[model samples]
Target: MDRTELAQVLTRARTALTPQDVGLPAGSRRRVAGLRREEVAQLAGVSVDYVVRLEQGRGPHPSAQVLSALARALRMDDDARAELFHLAGSAPPMPGTVDEHVRPSVQRLLDRLDDLPTMVLSARGDILAWNSLASALLGDWSLIPRRERNIIWQRFLGTPDPRRSTVAMDDDERRATDAQAVATLRATTARYPRDPAVQELVSELRRRSERFDELWRAGGSSTSWPFDRKAIDHPSLGRITLDCDSLHVPSSDQTVIVYSAEPGTPDSDALALLRVLGTQSMTTAG
Candidate 1:
């Protein structure tokens, strides 16, 4: 690996980003010119020590996965991402692989939706990006490891966040959701049969989660609904039901998931409150 060049590039990228670029608050009295090392660590789901070591040109060779996370965290463009992979002595993601990179336009769209809880998910159900309000309504996704960021993984294998407790859904609705996730994942695997990441994710989930295993074995298919309702247990807001809508991006094979509440309702008021509070209240409470 070109450790020196890698270190320089990583440092440059980190310093170029402001907190607001990554849906983080820009608090006053900051000493850093751009994002701090800890902030990059949080966004990349890596340790501060790791980031420090990497930037110092003394860290061990990062895996492709780590490089991918860092690229996303740094908001690298296509050319920059390719250079990062080359510097790390790894190949850039091929065409058939799951596209995790959120386009600049999509990122801007998320920023525009300031009041609603919005997130982008890959074909394999991995959460690729999210807005600040989404973090407030759900948990701070940045805190979760990149490998565990998939909605299918969270649904079947992840331990529930105590703060968000249960996603209140009827038995039928819950079952349907599970089936859809599995079917979607299955379809993704078929489309990218040679993708090791997709293969590994499915293998690991089937080995670890009994529910996932059962659904996978059943070979059931369900039509993915564009809209659904979910009652999420917010730590500060209590139970709030919101309309969950899925908008597909066909070019990238990604989905933008948005959560909205009807106007003039209690849930709408709660969402408005959440917008004002941002993620500060949740962070403090946790």
Candidate 2:
């Protein structure tokens, strides 16, 4: 990579963006045009030091995810995004690959949904981000290693809450869930044959789980993911059942899982309690 050119390009890009462009408050105490380093860092989900290093031609190459985030933060169009990747000495992510780039708009949505148990999952089932309530409802996914942070992997190979999830599944429901998961994985493999991470996941699942392989061979697929209810048997909160709905993001092909209960219900009360517990744990850990 031409560090000088890369730095110049990065600085130019950063200087070309404005607060209004990336969903930030327009401020009056501005000494310069475009976004500040801290603003860029916040929008890109990175640190200010990292942005400074990138602009100064001293940092290591940013990963694809970082590049994508920066491109989005700068409000670059598709062509500009491609040029940014080229200048950074990395090829732009091609179509058909699983997009790991969760847009800032999507991330903002997650951050704003503090009361709900929400999580973002990549097309291949990788857990990208989760809210505090999601951590309380499901396991704290962030603490898990990257390799084990996948829903399909967790279901098939990893030790996941041996004492059945509060999202109660009868035998038939279990079978359906397994089939759906396998189908999703199989579809991902078909979509991104060249993605090594995705390929490894599929290979590992097929080798490690007989049921996964059987379902894969049987070709489980549907038009879309189904809306379902989850019952989580919280060790403290007892059983809390909530409606589980998924929203598809066209830009990234990611799914956002939202957990909610009808207002004023007992389940809603339980979720509120879980939120309290989640907040307390975060505070204690901090």
Candidate 3:
């Protein structure tokens, strides 16, 4: 690794970004012109110490995921993102295919939302990483095989069950969700035309589900993924409705999904209860 050069690049990038650019608040009593190492850490989902090490050129080489997150946090363009990856001793990701790499910064962001249901999805709809509460609320995804970790695959190929969602969806709602899933998959296929696994998935779906095949013929795009509203039905907690929000790290082609209920509402309390249940399950497992 070119430690000196990497450090210089990181320092220069960090110094150039403003809080406004990254959607951070501009607090008072600021000393530096740009964001602090800690602020950058928060934005990038890394530790301040790691940020310091990187800026000082003393840290170990970063992963592609970390470099990509830093690229987004620093608002680097495509050229700069490629440079970041190259300096970190990796090739740039192929165009059209989304990066499936989940950064530590993203995990840190998930860790902070213990009371909410949060999960990460790769460009191909694979469930990458999810917190305990996400498992508790969304059903235990970890129990499923890795090959079956894809959202589109499970929705269409699995047993006909709309209850895969925590809430009861009317026929129209279920149809819409199904259509969206197929459309998203179609768009992904268009983007990663050469990905063997994705191609295999398309073949499998076409062979198995007539609905998926029909939708495949129709088509869909990532740009049209609707705003999500999710509801989970817990035998113990009843139902909790959450407004689902997504943050995409375009460079990595990974998205973090957070499900939150309005504060001061019963739905919020239900989510808190689920957190407790998740904690209990962990303790028991340990």
Q: How close is candidate 3 to the true structure, as a TM-score?
A: 0.62
Clashing residue pairs, backbone N/CA/C < 3 A, model 1: none
Please provide TM-scores, in order, for all candidate models, with all chains considered together: 0.93, 0.69, 0.62
Model 2 lDDT per residue over 7-31, tens place: 8887888788665444344557899
Clashes of each: 0, 4, 1
The candidate, 1 or 3, that scores higher on TM-score is 1
**In model 1, where do residues sit more than 4 Å from their true spots?**
222-227, 282-286
lDDT of 1 by residue, 47-130 (tens): 999999999999998988888889988888889999999998999988888888877778888888878999999888888888
Model 3 root mean square deviation, Cα atoms: 9.8
Candidate 1 matches the true fold with a TM-score of: 0.93
Flag clash pairs in model 2: 166-231, 166-232, 166-233, 167-231
Q: Give the candidates in order of TM-score, highest first.
A: 1, 2, 3
Clash count (model 1, backbone only): 0
